[model samples]
Target chain A: MRFDLEIKCKKIVGGRTKGKLLLSKKPINFLGMVNTQSGEITNTSNGFERQNLKGKILVFPNSIGSSVGAYTIYSLKSNNVAPNGIICTNNVDITTASGCAISNIPLAFIDNQRYNDLVNCIKILGKNKEIEITLDTEEGKIIID
Target chain B: MHLTRDEEKGLSGEYGEATSAAYRILVAIGEATDAEKLVPIKWAHVSGVNYNTIGDSGLEFLREISKDGKVRVNTSLNPMGFDRENLPELSPEFIEKQFEIARAYEKIGVIPTFSCIPYEILPIPQEGTQVSFAESSAAVLANSHLNIITNKESALSALASALTGKSPYSDLRIDENRSPMVEIVNETDLENELDYGLLGYFTGKTIQKSCTGICNISENTDMWSLKSLAAGIGTSGSCGMFQPKKPSKFIEKVNYGKREMNETRDELNTSEDGQLITFGSPQLGIEEISKIQTLMDGKKFTKPCKIFCPKSVFCKAKQYGIIDSLQKSGVDFISDACTCLTPLINKKNYDSIITNSVKASYYMKTSNKVSVALKSLKSIIKGYTV
Candidate 1:
């Protein structure tokens, strides 16, 4: 997944990349599942149970569940167990978006045709230690370099 | 964006630091929704339950700030299941801590009437009534069905809006935001609360990211059915907005729909397989529990059944020996938190669960990989268990 990337957010500030990218084809609900304080996927039924985001790009279709899901994301960030960047098939839910804005997590939504191709490439790249994500708001594309 | 002068003044700290904190939170929330101004509100409904995800820290912070002065507002709250009745005979120290938290809110004029369906106690806002509500499920119902205006405010922002009686004019406050994006047409006969629960699940699963309005409902819908639908939708999707066009006809619709759906599925309906019948995903209120006791007085469970309710109501039931009699009849009564959200139980233990709550059925579908049947409490006791 060596390509250019663009990002769109309320605001964007550069931060260090800490880990690999964990992708989920489905949306993730955090209310009863994720432990906000510990940043552990305490939810046994969650698709990403026991998976650590520490420094990974958490890719998901979108966020599901309560408005508190946003707060949980912030808790994860405060606990130093947040995704480095988020790549979503669509816009994150308002609650999760608010959490990302508050926590300053880099997020990019892919709405372009290239998204399908990019997703396939990213999956093949698997979880990497050092991958860069860029978002092009005008093009509605997220590039992984 | 569309802020009233009063809201602007509060945000600018004309009221006080506590109000200022609330204002900041509201402003952030308003900005998130791309709202330009604020709207005046009459009532404020707050979320009081401690779901570990929201944490106790936010509540603690609000309490600490409110200790300095009164909040100058009228407010209600979503119930927290914990209460003296539920956890009776606790240490004085524990009681003191709980009182301290309550006192903080009391100082700010928060009436701690622990309930989510405040409309049951307080008057529901009339159509186009602008109010500030926090709880997502309630907010959606109030805004969509009642045609009341309330932004899906964040926890602190809801408190701030309540204090000032104003919120940033946004999607919910504006008339245009009330438009239904997704119209859910019930093609099948939705005869009961369980059917509505299933309908809500199916709708949420299908139409993600859209506010749904259930239209053309069969005449059999009831309050319990609608509430179940709301609960299921709330759990299955991010939809906090739902308006049943003819809410007044809900009960009639549920009755009709239940009979039709059940009648159609009769061949598929099985006998009482001795599975557990659980209630109160949102925690049964006192009235609901009393109704259950009355219904179960002469009945014995053919199979094992468990009723989970808020600890507060559970205590009253215990004092009245309703708990004992129910337990003696093989119906285990447990209280604390909602069992629907409780991860302590194994899903594989039960062949199926029968519940009256639409919210429980919705969550169970996702949480438990089993056949969860919905039936009225009356039906359950009568052995017409699905």
Candidate 2:
């Protein structure tokens, strides 16, 4: 059987979203930190340079950049490389929160323990090893594999 | 949340697609922030003009929104990526797209004031009035100095506010919510602009995410010092607002000794071998420009220097013949845009840049293709003059 685990998280943005998880331990400043076209993390502090954020549930601690970060998130959406969903470990700021809302991206907030456990789930990047995330706002569920 | 009939209709698309979109964002953010209702605003200042920063995706959104949206209140735009007077040498990748972004904003009824220091160009609203402002330095000034209510609006939120002339009534708007959570004591000698700017950095760092009460400020604190100080705080930290302890209505005192201030300054101070000297990160006002003019009265810069400001302030400053002498001294005056945001300055030309603005120092390293060294205005002048 496929590994199925349910994680309790606060649903910030509404709508059902499902994808593989792309996690960042550091908070991102969407403005200069992400390449909207390629969806790669540009901020060095993020520790995952050149990694794409598209088609994944981006997990970060929170936002810590310019106010235009919201627009950067929307740029991803229009460019067709937008993240399926976002999960913040601690809290979401006005910038990211507005970005997720504008682009209709699904966002959820998980506690520190569950976020760490989720991060550990995909620690070793190997072939056929990915943490699949399914977020349903209506049912208020975050099922992970 | 309570919504008036007009607001409900607008949210339901009574006004148009743009207004509907704007209202939806307002309501969503308002609900999320626990704001009770929407409040009308007297002015709105918007950011996100640089094409290099926002990309093609931003232009598309602006084009569509500007075509369909109508701004109900007086709005001022922030600096663009290119100088509007005459296009400076820029990379081919961004030459065309930069002006296109400005066109989109212009189409949407935004006045092409093209400035970050809108508080200088326009009349300051009476105390306790509400406004929706985006630029961090300007928003802090509105809250702390102007006594107006705003919570540092996001680009999208500020645009939405511009479309509808209303913002979510929360944070600084509520008189009760204005209580200071922390106090910052200025025990260090804040002699000049850089010292005050670094003091702001210390204050913001010491009390992250809290309304601040600044203590021991010199009685003769001028607008320029406040501008630099606020710019530093807004650049490094995400503080809501800061006020003098004596003037603040409520806040508990927190000691900010010289040791702590020095430590923070030491951390921010970096030595980088560079050439370009820049001023007007937040777009200097008349006072700061005049000060620079007087300082550089009989001086010439051996190295290349630049000043970024808007047309309004530049014209007002030029009337006194200060800009002419500075230009004669090899200072290039760039108007209607900021240099560090776009391809305005070719990174290959300069090794690094020295600036009095903490905000410019941060962006020069982060977005611009150059290193930054922070220096005081006095030192910068002294180096060039004597």
Candidate 3:
């Protein structure tokens, strides 16, 4: 991959991986709104409702709802249907941080500005083609090719 | 964040995987929150006991950690799925999974005090004692009523605290953050626990600060009312703690009048009638049960009634024959399981529930996918008691 953009981010949980970007403008609720068995977004209005998040780097604003959402994330990992990594744009709550920690998933955060930049990059690259990005937790950046 | 030699060792895996994991979680959270160091805590009350809430994921996590995990501090547990003494007709798998969670916690050296109201049953440490409480209502009450210190911790963080006996010295643990940044003026009289719950819901939804100042509620507000207020705040939003007095300095001000209270009520109260009437989202204390015993006054319930209380409280009530009397009045006492997020009550079993607890109302609607008809304790007595 010929990497170009490198956006600074904060690492909540460690491990580097590359995967297609799956973006959501709204905060996610893992407990009820995400199906653990299939890694599908269950909320009717969440845009990517029926889409499977398996192996994708999920980009979202943040997590909401019960703290048990942490367990739902862990459940996803245990069930072998989970995101490759998670990138939160706004905030990294205890629920998100702990969930990712327990599940050994690379979780990172970016500022709203960087989030906008990533969104623009995705827009320009077009959504039809899968956008593979490298998430380096140790480097604390999201590298786009 | 600074870590002592022992803390560093724990983080470096000298102590074991569980301790290392706990330290990592605390340090990560501490660094994120900009805490200077980890603080020692006297107690840790952990949540995530209910199988319905955590599902398979939580059970697996618990099993994995329980292998090497042991509590470093006095740790307590939250409510589980059902009462062991009076088991409801739950699925075999749910019962088995719920027991596995209990066994895991027991193996990890949790006190098995399967009640949300730790402040109610457990002996109070000093007023300024630092604790890690995952139960949101208990955390709020610890800060507001008991003058103890704790952030409204998530289930995993509190579990990490249990294993490590330390928490991040950030958020409400810091003295500066304890002061309310928002002022919530109560414009209407809070006549009952439900009203206080509504006021709390209003304050929590409106204020985004770590703590808020609640004016006009008397310092003499009773314990039940305070618990309701705590549960309501814990349910609706992330505002963890509150003060009964006006804030010395505040950036925002909001009012909790009849309109605001009605708005909250309308949001939570989705059903005009309910099939089952329930009490105790924060498991009913002995005092609350006693009050209910008196209120029953030998009258039977018009509808099926279930009262979720702590086993300790249930035993005491049973000793007094209050349980016997209430049982005669067709009130079923369920210990070790609460009304909120319990598999015992769900959309499959019941279409709607009647509850006086704002916390219960919120979770029943959202988590259980059932409608809620929120009523005051007094109003329930008036309408349901025959």
Candidate 4:
């Protein structure tokens, strides 16, 4: 398939899906920062505050705070409100990896260089336009629009 | 990552649904962390037990996994919401949900110790043994003091380890990563466990390494002080381990002097006084309880005081008549519960709480929404028990 942009990433959890990218510039602590019932980002300090993570490919720098954050991710899935996929711009911490693993959410990690390219593309394309991100594990690439 | 045939089978669902799920989780984490393979672990101390922490979603997953999952290794549990025998005046809904979580873990064949300090009650494996511990304080202690290997596992990863007896051979488990990347020197004179806790909190917040070497700590620092240090670092940052060694020639260096110590103390101590006094965050072992008993010296607490510890420790204390003696002084000994995230101390009933544990203070302020009057155990005993 042809794509406007493709970034190489190390796959943490294997699967393929496409969704609008929801970027979080800061690290997230899912336990308290997210409303598990609705999969809404409750942390007001983060840019994506009050944003529902239901169908977006939630991208973040990292995951921090309590280990219970992993369970919160699982909670998001069990509530039918999890993101289609998660892509970390940095290392995939235990909280993100384990949560994505148990919940079966496709997880991938992009290096700093590729992440910058993705960010610049988003900036040029504008945030108002929906940017579909495809986590193609079989091809080991994150295809973006 | 490469996988053995057995692991491959487990991942492919040949070994059953639960094992397949466990293998999948391990493989995913292993690959993410660049682990070539999985290593066998002897124990797994899992967290995510508190109904307050995990909520309905965690409960749902636990129930589903427990249907076919049984631990392959010796597994212990973290503290639940409240004491099972002496249930607090919580909502019936909470009690029911908490019990459901308990049943799920029990069904999955965990030890159900409901104590975070599993090293205290359980027989610790020989030195250099690998284990998966989700409790932060316990993970720190296992690495720093017990000479065990772990990566400060999350609740789900530890649970997966318990199910499969395997962990990703990366992070802290790698021998090269065990050494400190930074050196934290204590430039201030320490007085009590509270001081040690502050020093640890400072190191944890400042140092950006997997482990650090702490210098100038007395060789004879008590267990309470070490426990406080472990609790402090575990709460403040992601650094899972520390060593009480002198600064090496290489690596970055930071000093934990009075300024840093006072800053940490100010950060955690939010209240002037608290209605309740709690003794444990990493649950009180017999040593701490014995020290408290000695300090109490038959003096009654001026206010409500509770000591959270393991049921095994409580039993031992009772056997030694220490619990009975402490009870006479109006100190409620709560077993199978912890000070952190305990529903027993809530904003509705108590405006604040006093504890020596920075870890407990952090959780009480953030999660429980109650202010904390953090103090040294000695000071608390002297001031409140008179």
Candidate 5:
């Protein structure tokens, strides 16, 4: 099923475009060991075991756990392991928003009525190096490159 | 943005290298919140601790900034995950680095409290009180639980705030931001302090993005239980800030149990007859120490136990003749920052631990796997095992 989804997020800092896309299917926990620089879930539970997102667009449902989660994102950006962009199914969690704002990681929120279906459709999109994320909000539509 | 003359001078790089860094940090934070001007602050808590656990560069940076001893400011410090004095088994180089970092902070007037729960040692600000705090958990707790006004100031901003006694008026300093957006209703009757932790988890899961205040806490709520709940909520959500209903006598009893459970979790054992007792995991206040002394005046300890308290408190107890009385009862009073953080426990050491604080219990679980039975100080002094 093909459908269009759009969202709006406060632009954090932008990063250099790398050639790989590491996407996360499940929601990410801010407290768990996610190597911010490597974009890899280094020491996490079984759910996030072996997940690495270096140079990929991070697609998750939301951020879970800890106010420091926001700072950790910035830490990852500083270390250069941060994702090129982020696309969330819903409104970005506060920590994620703060991190994105602080790190200048491009963010887009997609409003798909059936988010699960859209996630499945976009599953292949995360494997690519360069892809545009169209963010639609009342303010305007911003095409993040 | 309107800045005081000093702030303007600092921003203009008139105050040398370190002050310039502080000024830039404050300006960035102000810009983020769109704050028009910076306000004067009285005290500040600084972060960026360099120890075995932190980055070497961060530690070096802190050392450089703190070397001058010219920074005469009232400042609190964040916790360093690694403690060289406490953990002697670690690497020698790591320990040396930690001592160097500690010395730097001490030179800069940052008391080596090194506790995340600074409110336990530092005084809570009154209503309309403005201070610069960097630790997020403490900031949320102080603002939401204690009704104080503080921003989650950056590490550099906290230093600047301490130097100038002012911060940008934003976020937590504002009144409207402190109000609870979400109200949590306790569906079940919470009996033990652990139940409070579970409830906090539940609230964080249910409330999503909104700030919450938990209502309908049972009359038997204590500091340990509240601290446990707060920590759990903090782990579960971005921040944990809740105001609980005032606790009753029963709640105080539960609080003591939480503390004992925390202290005895790893160091001692509790049989059906033996109760592992703990003191000063939360670093007992003077009032609590006095009360404990009064209760132990003529009591005898039938079981081997440990009393975890601060060096300052232990000295005070020694000065007041309370330490003599405690020693007579076979209770070993140990001066340590955090007993729960200690890795000196064996499986056969104790069957159970009795504690009054919830933070002790929660953190102890990381190293020791034992049953923790929590009770009140009154019960412990009465020679009752919980």
Candidate 6:
């Protein structure tokens, strides 16, 4: 079944972006968890280990460690290996927000109340088919097939 | 977010690239947090100086802004990866990279304090003074102990404030957000710094994201104990300033038991046969230096033990003759950085480490990739007596 789900983005940066959805239930620490040079996820415990976030839509709950994680995200952009778009399901801290703003990466976030539902939906949405995100519009939505 | 015409111009790139970049960052962060307007900040203490952690991308960003723009307000930098002068055994390549990072910050008009405890040299902001601080312990300390207003800003946010002399009006800076959301009942009497630290760790783990009110503290509580709590909570969980009052009108109330504190203490303790004993996680002050010197007097140690403190206090130690005698006892000093934040972690691999800080124990597991045996300073210092 194909579905069109609308994500009520509380905050948006860089208008619109689209890419295949890559989701992680665990929070990320950009400093060590991400390889800025290649845009690959490094932290093994998160299950996305060695997976490249480049040209993908990176989704997660919130930031787990250091404020320096923001620069890691910025480095991803500067090196031309950044995620096409980002969606954090909790408070968009200055670290993640600044990373998106400085790098011109599109970012959208869901509030805590609806964050869990979105996580479950993404897990199910990524089961068999591909998913894409388009954040250019004021409304943040994902097209699922 | 509302912006004045001047701020609008800064956003429009009329104020040059540096100001425009910094302005755009602040406005974005402010908008994310639902901030209404911008406010001037008196101080900015930024972290993420460890080049080994942030790598080349961070260097690129720092140099890009610092080459043309200077900091607008007083600023302090956090620790770097290596001690370029004292730690001569480090690779020259690593030393050059560390120097590059330092120069980038210096060019931006940041004081090369390189200490996590920025309050050591920078004057503590008076109560209710708006400030932009990034280091977790420093943020909590400025808010709870020193009565200064701050939100836990990111490295970039703090850097932006350093360049622009302002931050978006946000959570902790607002007066209404200062009220406690949780009242923590603490009947247990904390005897030592470790106890205070464990309690703080417990508070952070228990009340994950609330402004907690802690009560039943002794009147004799000093800044050292407060620092232990602040550092513990900062590292363990994302907690903001804690009010020192008893149970009050708050949404949630949590009771801290001695059993839970003991469990945490046990969890933190590793092998007693530690390869190295490290002190000064947050960088020791003059009083701590004097205390350690007093304990190490006329004694010899066997383990490769070192105490970390900033250069400011290192000078104080030398002036007090604390370093000379301690050096004779086989103790080395790491000046200009804290042990946890420095790149020494990756270089110095160990089977086990002994430290007096719960915060140190937490960070060591991540930063150094090793476990730590949590000990009281008195116990660790006394164990070295020959």
Best by lDDT: 4
Ten residues in a row with the worst lDDT in model 5 chain B? B247-256
Q: Is the docking of candidate 3 incorrect, acceptable, medium or high quality?
A: acceptable
Task: Tell me the tens digit of each residue's lDDT in model 6 across B287-314.
Answer: 8778877777768777777888888888
Quality of model 5 by C-alpha lDDT: 0.55
Which model is ahead, 1 or 2, in terms of TM-score?
2
Measured against the true chain A, the candidates' chain A TM-scores are 0.71, 0.88, 0.93, 0.94, 0.65, 0.83
> Could you give the DockQ of candidate 5?
0.20
Alpha-carbon deviation at A134 in model 3, angstroms: 4.3
Error of 4 at A113 (Å): 3.1
Q: Rank the candidates by DockQ, best first.
A: 6, 4, 2, 3, 1, 5
Residue B240 error, candidate 5, Å: 5.1
- lDDT by residue for model 2 (A2-99), tens: 66777777766788989887777666657656778788776574477577888998887677536687888999998888899987776556677778
For candidate 6, state the interface root-mean-square deviation in angstroms to 1 decimal: 2.1
Candidate models: Cα lDDT each: 0.59, 0.77, 0.85, 0.87, 0.55, 0.77
**Cα-based TM-score, every candidate:** 0.73, 0.90, 0.91, 0.91, 0.66, 0.91
lDDT by residue (B1-386, candidate 4, tens digit) is 78899899989988778888888889888988899889999999999999988998888888888989999999999999888889888899999999999999999999999998899899989999999998878888899998889987889899999999999999899999998888898899989988988887787667656788999998789888988888788766667899888877787888788788888888889999999999998899999999888988999999999999999999999999999999999899898889988888889889999999888887787667899998988899889876
Q: What is candidate 1's lDDT per residue for B143-228, written digit by digit as tens?
A: 65566777554455566667667676766577765656656655576555567666665555455644656666754555556566
Off by over 4 Å in 2: A1-10, A22-26, A46-51, A109-130, B91-95, B246-270
Looking at candidate 4, what is the lDDT of residue B265? 86
Evaluated on chain B only, what are the TM-scores of all the candidate structures, in order? 0.72, 0.94, 0.98, 0.98, 0.67, 0.94
